[model samples]
Target: MTTDALIPHATGRADDPQVRRRAARVAGIGYLAIFVLAIFANFVVRGSLVHPGDAVATAADVAASESLFRAGLAAFVVVFLVDVPIAWALYVLFRPAGRDRSLLAAWFRIVYTLMLGVAAVFMFLGLQLVTGGPGSGTMGPEAGMLMFEAFDYAWLVGLVAFGVHLVLLGRLITASGLAPTWLGWALVVAGVAYGLDTMAVTLLPDYAAIADVMLLVVALPSVVAELSFTAWLLVTGWRRPRVAAETA
Candidate 1:
C-alpha cells in the first residue's frame, strides 16, 4: 500500500486548519505551565530550603517550611503530567510534515517525562527524610541531602534526552513552514546548549566555578526558543500558507 493510503482519511481532524490551531493553543498553555512550575519549584522553594554543603541547615529549613517543600514537589509532578498532552499536541501539530519523525520526537519527550517522574521520587524521599518519616532517625540530615542532590542530578541527566527531542521537533517545525525559520533554528541551538552544558558539568570537575557564567550565556537563548514559540502559538496560531500537500 502507498503511504498516502496508509493514512486514515476518515479522521480528517489532523488536516483541519481549525484543529491544528487549537492544538497550537493547547501546546502554548502546556509550555507556560512547564516554565512557571519549574521556576517556582527550583528557585523559590528549593532555593530557600536547600543549602549546599550544609545539610543540617538545609534539613532544618525544610522541616520549618515543610508545606512549601511539599508544594514544590507537587509542582514537579504537575509539570511531568502536563508534558504528556504537550507531546501529543506537538505531534499532532507537526505530523503533517513527517509522521515518522513527529512520532520519534514525541517518544523522546515521553522518555524525558518518565525520567523526571523517577527524579520526583527522590525529591519526595528527601522531603520524607526532613520530616522525620520512617527511618529518619537512622538516616539523618545527610541522607536527606544526598536524596536532594540525587533529584538535581537526575533532572540534569534527563535533559540530555530532552535535547534530542528538541532537535527533532525543531527540524519538523522548520520543514513544515508552520512557524518562523528562525524559531526552529533557535530550538536547534537550544538543544546544543543543553547537551554541552550537561557534558561540561558531568565531565569537568573544575567547570563548577564557571558554570553560572556558562548557564547565563546559553540559558537565555534556550528560554527564548520555547517561550517565543509558545507565545507565537498562543497569539498568532500558525503562519499562513500551510503546506498544501499536507493540508489537502
Candidate 2:
C-alpha cells in the first residue's frame, strides 16, 4: 500500500470495515455455538434418578446410562476450542492499532480458555475412569468419588481463573470504545457468577448442591444475555464503540 494509504487517521488506524464486519459475524456465530453446547452439557448431566430403594450396584451403571454427559462434555471442549479463534478475531477487529500491546488484553482470553481446557481435561479423565466398561471393578465407589472430587477441584481453580478473565475482558470492552456498556457489564457479571458458583464446591464442602442450583439459575440469565448480545451483533454489527463524546 502507498504511504498515504498506510497513514494513521484520527481513529488511530484506518482498518478495513469489511474485515471488522466479518470478524463480528464470526464471533457472533461462535458464541451461539458455545451456548448450544452448554445446553447440551446440561442435558447430558441430567440423568435418571437412581432412588435409594432401587437395587443400584455400581457407579458405573450411573455413568453408563448417562454417557451423554461424557459426550456433551467432549462436544463442549471442541466447541470451546473453536471459540478461541473466533474470540481472537473479535478482539483483533476492535483492538486499537498503533498502541502498545505489551500487556495485550487477548492474554486474558487465552488464559481463560486454557483454564477451561484444563478443567475439561480433569473432568474427562474422571468420566473415563468412572464409566464402567471392562475394567470397572478395579475402582471402588470411594475411588470413583475421589476421581470426581479431583475433577471438581481442578474445575474450581479453572473457574476462578476464568472469572478473572471475563472481568478483564469486560473492562477491556468498556475501555476500548467498542460495544455497549450493558454488554460489558453482562460479561463481567457472568464471569463473576462462574467463580462464585464454583466457590461452594471449592470452599464449602456441604454447599455443593446449593452451588449447583445457584449455577442453574444464573446460567439461564447468562445464556439469555449472550444470545441477545450475539443477535444484536449479527444484526447491527458494532455501533461505533461507545465513546464519551457519543454519549454526550
The per-model lDDT (C-alpha) reads 0.84, 0.59
Model 1 Cα lDDT, one tens digit per residue, 82-174: 998788878877878888998999999998899899999999998888778976777878999999999888887888888889999899888
How does residue 171 of candidate 1 score in lDDT? 92
- Per-candidate TM-scores read 0.88, 0.70
Estimate candidate 1's alpha-carbon lDDT, on a 0 to 1 scale: 0.84
lDDT of 1 at 130: 75
Return the lDDT, model 1, position 77.
97
Per lDDT, the best of the predicted structures is 1
